[model samples]
Target chain A: MGRLKSRQAGKKFLAVTGLFAMGVMLLLPIFVALPALAGGAPAAGGPPPDVVAAQEAEGVEGEEVKVEIGRDVYYKTEGPAVGAPAPKTADTEEFYPRYNFESRVLLWVANQQHLYYGSFVLAVPIFCMCIEFAGLVSKDKAMAKKYDQLAYDFVKISLTAYSLTAILGGILIFTFLTLYPAFFGYLSSIFRPVMHIYALMFVAESGTLYIYYYGWDKMKDGLLKWLHCSMSVVLNVIGTVLMFLANSWIGFMMSPAGVDEQGRYLGNIWHVIHTALWNPLNVHRILGNMAFGGGVVAAYAAYRFLSAKNDEERAHFDWMGYIAMSLGVAFLIPLPFAGYWLMREVYAYRQQMGITLMGGLLAWLFIIQATMIGILFLTTNYYLWQALGRMTGGERFQRYIKYFVFILVVGLLVFITPHTIVMTPAELKAMGGQQHPVLGNYGVMSAKNGGINAIIMTTIASFIWYQRGNRVPAVKWAKFGNIFLITFFVVAHLNNIWVACYGYFIPANVRIGLSVPQVAGTLSCLFFGSALNLAMLSKSRELGPIRWGQIAPRSQYALIMLATAFTWMMGLMGYIRSSVRLFWHVNEIMRDNSPWAYTHTIGFGANVISFNVLFFWITILFVFWLGALGAKKAPVPATQPVPGAAPQPATGH
Target chain B: MQTALYLIISIVISVAYFQFIDWALMDMQGLDYFYILR
Candidate 1:
């Protein structure tokens, strides 16, 4: 025993020392680069005589003009304005070479892959923080330990993917430099300072993440655990900042600001970073990353559950899947609202761009997106309902499933209905127009909005049912609370449909405002109904200890399907957003004069998205295998109780 | 007044749809029977 104790002590000592060494090594690069970064600035040069002469001639007598002109010369900004004369071919040629092959497709794959890994690494740490906090607060030692173990497992999966993210990022840069050197150079010149900060933050995130993972065992007790969890916060902050910096680059491309009509950086890097679309894009991507991460993690849990040999292993993985799915669905519910805000911002930035996306060329893609979203919600509800099988009292809610299913199906049918159909001239004539007379009305935003809100509310209702699946509410007012909850949902649904219907009669300007109250109605049901359910269940009686490992195998497949759908949807949406710039490398500022400037057919786009999804799944499965091998070598601590044993609720309330 | 009537009627129909489901399938009065505390 003493020998084992000494050996363990030696291992812990080495682990701590190794972490310290890694931290120092990581900081060494930052320290060396700091001095260089501090001294690095564009070479001092006066504004060109012609620019100064022109400014004076035009009587542009302000500090802003002089400053802008000076910065323009330094940054080599030379793009045409929105309505200005088209830039000469020679000017555009200097930045982008005439590539023989399709460079855009190559860049697309690289970017999407990087984003997937980047989002996974960024989001898993957040899950880690939440789970670790849950562990810290729980009075039940066994349950707390289980939470910690689950968190540790989550970080482990992301650790391998982090290395892949960096590798993919390097490939992305190399692709840009080789294929689109001119365009990359111009962008780099504009975002020189941001690039430096991004690099430094990357190093910080890497160091913090490594320390957090390696020191997990050592910090499992008391004060060190809190410190360890705090490291996750620092990691996430750096990660978010890194993401924001990258987003600015994309946002600037989509909606160029802080520059002249002739693509010139106007001295204010802050303005360039905070372009009009920046915040909306940031919000959209953050929510997207969280949802995608949840899907991926849930898929990982499902894989483990399917392969487990023992009931204990199965039970653990089953619980993990539930937590991951719940987190993912929670983010999924509000994702459409974020998407709506983004589209609104897009319209605000440029009406033509918005019209092109929604009503013109890219409208078909939105229809495809509707189909994917419908599938996502349907799968989520199905998984939740399937989960009910593990609860003893869940049978009581079984009959209600059919009703929810009816609502979901109808909503999905409405949500996916396309406004126009692609057909031959004769077919179009037969229909009397591009739209089917009967289905045309269901295809517009009014009907779609109603459909989605109803879907969301139904999903929320499923969740409430799932929460109460194993418990019999013990509160004296449980019936009243249930009645109020049901009534609230009914009313909320009515309000949502009313808003949707009212939108049709209102003018377009007023119709857009209707979405606010519609979303509010859904949120009211989500928050208030959930709150009521929880209050009633606080002192509830258990039907039985939840049979965690008893869930049907089909539900595991649903988890995989959710992940696959999320991956494909993200790829498609990224393509749509990027393509909206249409023929322009930087919106109206810099035109893309490549052979592949035209948008590809929807069929081709779908094929490419599927290829990317397949590639990601294949690669991620390998990563999962690597994680599994590591787990086998150093298994999670067996602090959890045996399978089928009920975890005692934390007491002393 | 016409718009108001349309809106109100739409809401009523929507709410009534769910209410019909409950009346047909769920024994609403038996809800408290499932609650152990009550």
Candidate 2:
């Protein structure tokens, strides 16, 4: 009994010691990291006993940069006389950074560039599908041949863009190494293996891309076509892998797992990469990129249309815009869900950060995001309405547009209001609170749920409008489809509104979960309505001839503007999501520079991002116009997919 | 239908597994990149 007791006591003691050691490792960093990240100095009267001892033993550089009583050390930097920042010495209020802003921003920009470059390269192959479809459907030999050439152009453009992307990647790497040698050292050490994998993936991607683009002609036939399509899939796969690898780094940065709390290097890199938030961020980012890419491509199409000299160009541009819009909106429908999932994970990782994102620091950005989403929906509706005039049965659908306009606009305004204003004490006394009374509810999940669903519902309304005017259905179940369309949306709306209402009263977690069902309902209607409409139109005919080049070109530019808006909004939303950890570099553990970390006003953020979008659009438009300028117009075949003459009216099936 | 259901279940499980592994790898290396020392 005595021996047994001793053995058990020894085991208990070992377990207790292990727990204490682990606790120390975790808790010590929580105390150490905060002041370091905040750039806060030791108290002014005298250095802490510990700090004094450390200062006494300081290295030569440390001794030279002794802390003054009041002023920040960062104020004495040895940079340019005109452009220099304060010195980053012991006296500075600024934290001893692992890195500087330029280095930080470069890495940030590099990561973004990397994601987008891969996205564009991957998207090129996906766009190839339309060309393949055109090749299959075009009855006239001449038309089929034009489509083949178009496919050739698509691949050609991707090849050039791919090269630019590579150059950008190289530039990013060099910038990282040159700007923050110290920070780069710390980063490169941890991510050495990931960087190796990324390098290999890029090489593989380059080779595959070249082969895919060059081999198009060689593999033009049935088996070759299959091969070509397969190559596109491979390209996307590799691109996705690259994105995932990169996401691991970003995700880990936000929620570094597998390490003891002091930010020490852990043995298993995989543990770091697959931090809890990694998967959701990957999902959200990938979807956002696809939607953004679609918008960009669509805008390009619109730009082409606005510049076209004749009807054929207009017709082509119109079709391209419609398809691009469709693709963009299609990906966009599920985007909010992914975003929601990301936010959910953020809350799960740390609730304080999530609260700051929604209720405190970054809430204004969310309001702006709400406004952008509203614009996206509104523009989408207007474009669809314009496109409807070209279709056979399109006129009847025009009447319903007014109702949708009202619902979407009302929902949008309510969605974008700031929940909490920066009120003076006097203002607070008048208002009776920090949070606004009636307006505060609009910033809640209930209002956003309603707003997004309303937006979605409106987009579907536009799609239905467009579908109605474009073609007359030939399906045996045409009557059933009409009924289905009506019922599906009606039921979907009822369900969504029900949840939105109930969400207001429920506990927060339950209210949040309710959104899943609501979103799923909208998706059901969106897909069901779309598929039903497509099936109905497959064998249908045009009620009227499409007079493409007749419309004002400025109207078409609106599509490009919408696309640009989409990109900027996505970037903004991404930043907001990232900045949720209000003052933390990493949530809770690493405090950020609190003053700069607060969100700038919505107006300012929007103007700057719009500038980014505008800059890109102008440059890309120039590229697009340049590409089109060299084009020689080939004669279009008389018959499109339809059986009859110019208008292809095959109405009475 | 049963086979399809089983296959879907298996696929979901596998995907979750892979996603977890991939995410964890990213976390360790990525945190440093973001300057999250703690």
Instruction: For each candidate, report its DockQ versus the true two-chain complex.
Output: 0.03, 0.02
Query: Evaluated on chain B only, what is the TM-score of candidate 2?
Result: 0.64
Docking verdict class for candidate 1: incorrect
Residues A1-653 of candidate 1: C-alpha lDDT, one tens digit per residue: 99999977876676566556646754775887675567675322224469658868767655444232422322345432212222433334454554665778899899889988999998899888888888899887777878898899999999999999999999999989987776777777777778888998899889889989998987776555666776777778788889999999999999887667676665556567888899998988988998899999999999999999988898888888888888888888889999999999999889999988988899999999999999999999999899989989999998889999999999999888887656799998988887777866768887899999999999999988888888889998776566666767878777677667766765666566556667767776777677778789888998887898899999999999999999999999999999999988888877887667899999999998999899999999999999999889967566568434333211110
Top-lDDT structure, candidate number: 1
- Off by more than 4 A, model 2: A1-118, A129-148, A474-481, A534-554, A581-607, A629-653, B1-38
Report the lDDT tens digits of candidate 2 across residue range A436-554.
Answer: 67656656777678778877877876776565565678777666566555655655666567557766765664555566556656666566667767778777766776554444565
Candidate 2 residues B1-38, lDDT tens each? 75455455545543443334323433533322112232
Query: Which candidate tops DockQ?
Result: 1
- What are the per-model C-alpha RMSD values against the true structure? 10.0, 18.0
